[model samples]
Target: MARWKIKNVSVSGVAMAVPKNVVKTAELGLLSQEESDVFDNTVGIKSRHIAPDSMCASDMCQAAAEKLLEELGWERDSIDVLLFESVTGDYRTPPTSCVLQDRLGLSENCFSMDIPMGCCGCMYAITVAGNLLTSGNVKRALLLIGDTALRMGSMKDKSRVPLFGDCGTAVALEYDETAHDIIVDFHTYGKGYEALMTPHGGFRHPATPESFEYEDFGNGIVRAPIHTLINGMNVFSFAISRPPKSIEKFLADYNINRDTDIDYFLIHQANKMIVDRIVKKLKFPQEKVPYNLEEFGNLGGASIPSLMVTRIADQLRTKETTLLMSSFGLGLSWGTMCLKTKPMVISEIVFL
Candidate 1:
């Protein structure tokens, strides 16, 4: 079997949008006087952008795609495939990709669909798009990821509300047989479905008035009656352990060590603390970990790509850089991809 190679990968364009109002951790009263005393003992957040009442995940995604198309000078009909990734959608039926396709005026023959994943979404979507391009089935593909999970009634719960922010990201991938990029691995475990999920609004339990009533779990905070319930501690522990092990497994297969090896670590922006713990355990340089959670908070599936477009693209030079990109969260799902590419400067867009 012949191995796939990335001919050329350029983030042709990128854009992002946040809610009109900025919410700071201090305003949420998340820390006590004693908890706030220590210098490093912080609530792990400064501020995050929340979407306006009228904006949905799809709307934010559309804005990003529009900007990318303009910057790349891509005609609407030139898009061969559109992949939409998000855990939050406008509806359960009719994938959001269809809505984007129509809004963008893509050709009728274009292949468009949606992938519902949490934090790991962008990595997974890129892997899938790369495969389709390498198979000679498509010439160019667009990957859009955005989420309004924060707007879900469940996010109103104090614990989650502070951790999530609404945002969208867009990346354009063109077919390139000469490119040296490879998706090393991808995997998921659904057994932990109940451990983190919206308990009352899917096939198992349709939304009902009774289901929306708050019940005390003795945690002092009232759990949302209709929102997704995530066991935060459980999710955090699972995330910190999995990605490092997965990266180690990939390195062993390739027979490479960390020191004089990988150039960058573009892990998910799930949480500042989670990223901090992984950096320490993996012994990765603190500077290599690209963290945007402090300003953008958690954009769910959009986190990694948003960081790439906003921060990573602008800093590339002409050398083969090794990047270990990983994402883990909701669905208890996670994945990591190793990318090797020559540095190319990405043009920055003035985000609104």
Candidate 2:
């Protein structure tokens, strides 16, 4: 296997638009005790970025991609490939990538597609771009991922109300001979499919009025029974076990176990608890882990790259730093990559 280097990896654009209104956990006091407890404890989310009534995943993604292209000063013709990775796509038929390409005014020569991974999407997309760049077929690739599932229901369902937020992130990858080394490893375990899933609205179980009806969970808070059933314990257990295992496997593959050998660790910002668990279990240094969940909640597929753009890219001082990034969730999938790179400028686009 030839080692592919990620040269000139820059986040050309980053923009996030939230619902006009913001809901806080404290505001959920009107709900029953069990409801409030689940919202506050398991979710551990104080607030999340809910999209406006009119916005969908593609709308936010296009807005972010436009800003990224503007910042990079590159025309649509320069991009050879466009990948939109998201669990909540704009439509079921025509892939969301097609809609995004047309919306962004990319040339018809550009190849566009969608990756259906949920939270691990950003990492998976980056891995694909890295391979394409290394394969010599494409010089520049645009990767975008986001989700707007938070708008699927009212704020009454405490189980999900605080667990999701909406945001889009774009990354520009270019081929550079002098760029840093990049290595990626992806893994999946499908046995736990029922553990965490949005069971309705897919080919397996098409959406029906029955799926939308309310069901009592022995509490005053009646929720759409099959909406997004996330067995918190199962999800957490899988996350805690898999992420560190992959990270360890990566380190062992490279024949090193020292903490200082790695510069930064960007784990998927699923929740503060998962972040803490991974760091503790791996015994990774505190500074190595970069977390922004408290501010952004969970941006689903966009979480990892968005953190890199917002937090990591700006603070990098030299080009030799070794960074480790991993994302896990939905599909019960996870991916880890070890990248060595030089500092590069990332443009920040203001989301109005």
Candidate 3:
């Protein structure tokens, strides 16, 4: 149980970016027209924005960060820390955050690093940034989180190709003694790590010539070793079970009243079935949990922030709201974060 409360840091703004290319579920041709319709209705993903080969996750995050900084009217030199989270970075060598620091024109003294995480990454990254601010050494920080997961799947694999989207998000935070506390609860189960992963391309099993060869796994699932491999049933079970339990414990530990204490529950947009099951198990109000999976698909780490920008930006920008966000997946990890946000800038979703 890695849980703690951080004080004196407040979220100032949020922004998101996605590729301009919109790929509708019907266009994938992975399923028959009838099956595609069923997938769209049951999974709640009708379309997704996919980045081309020329675009990388860093590019989208830079776009989002730029927009957020401009809207917040903050000088780049004022940023003291920068954190970039993504499973798929621009390269295996250079840490993407360093490149972003230069790209964003932040001060040379600014602290920059990369956090390679998956679904629960945004909340985890926020916690990391919040703690840095609490140290009193950092005055302002920017959190950049997203993934180009759509590019990691084989187009022939219906189970995965249609279920992922590319997106990038930026969150601005600054140290403020008067700010509300940010509480985060984290849990990890390494035993279940294999539930979702890309087994190839890493040092453990460096990519070989055979890694690029596609294999038919039946049921319209076909992929290369280098592509993502997900045990859907295992992942579904973990998503619906562990995350809800974690959220429940978090609420009880903090003595939070879900119906009154929190204005919104921004759950990760994993899928309609998984999300619905978790919401049902927790007995959380459906209205308070907005769903953008229908339009953006599952954006991995970007799902939660994308929800703020796409679904509740207006509310978050105009009123003081208490938000509780939970995300679980990949790394067999789950987390819940509670924070208070005041009326602040939320830039329009940038399409690249």
- Candidate 2 lDDT over 223-323, as tens digits, reads 67457766778998999998788778778887655476787888888888888888899888997788777656788888876776667765653355677
Query: What local distance difference test score does each model get?
Result: 0.72, 0.73, 0.92
> Candidate 3: deviation at residue 255, Å?
1.1
Model 3 misplaced stretches (Cα beyond 4 Å): none
The better-scoring model by lDDT among 2 and 3 is 3
Instruction: Itemize residue pairs with steric clashes in candidate 2.
Output: 19-50, 319-342
Query: Order of candidates by TM-score, top first?
Result: 3, 1, 2
lDDT tens digits by residue: candidate 1, 1-352: 1223344443344466555677776565644544433312343556778787788888888878787688678888988999999878777889888888899899988898899878888877777787777766778888888888777745435567777788877877877666665754665677877767878877788889888788766543556556777687788878788778887777787766777667778888777778888889888877777777877787888887777666777555345567778788766677767776655434353244
Please provide, for model 3 over 8-74, each residue's C-alpha lDDT reduced to its tens digit, 9 standing for 90 to 100: 9999999999999998898978888898899999999999999999999999999999999998889
Ten contiguous residues with the weakest lDDT in model 1 = 34-43
RMSD of each: 2.9, 3.1, 0.9
Q: Considering every candidate listed, which one attains the maximal lDDT?
A: 3
Query: In model 2, what lDDT does residue 350 have?
Result: 35
Q: List the residue pairs that clash in candidate 1.
A: 6-179, 7-178, 7-179, 19-50, 19-51, 154-227
Score candidate 2 by lDDT: 0.73
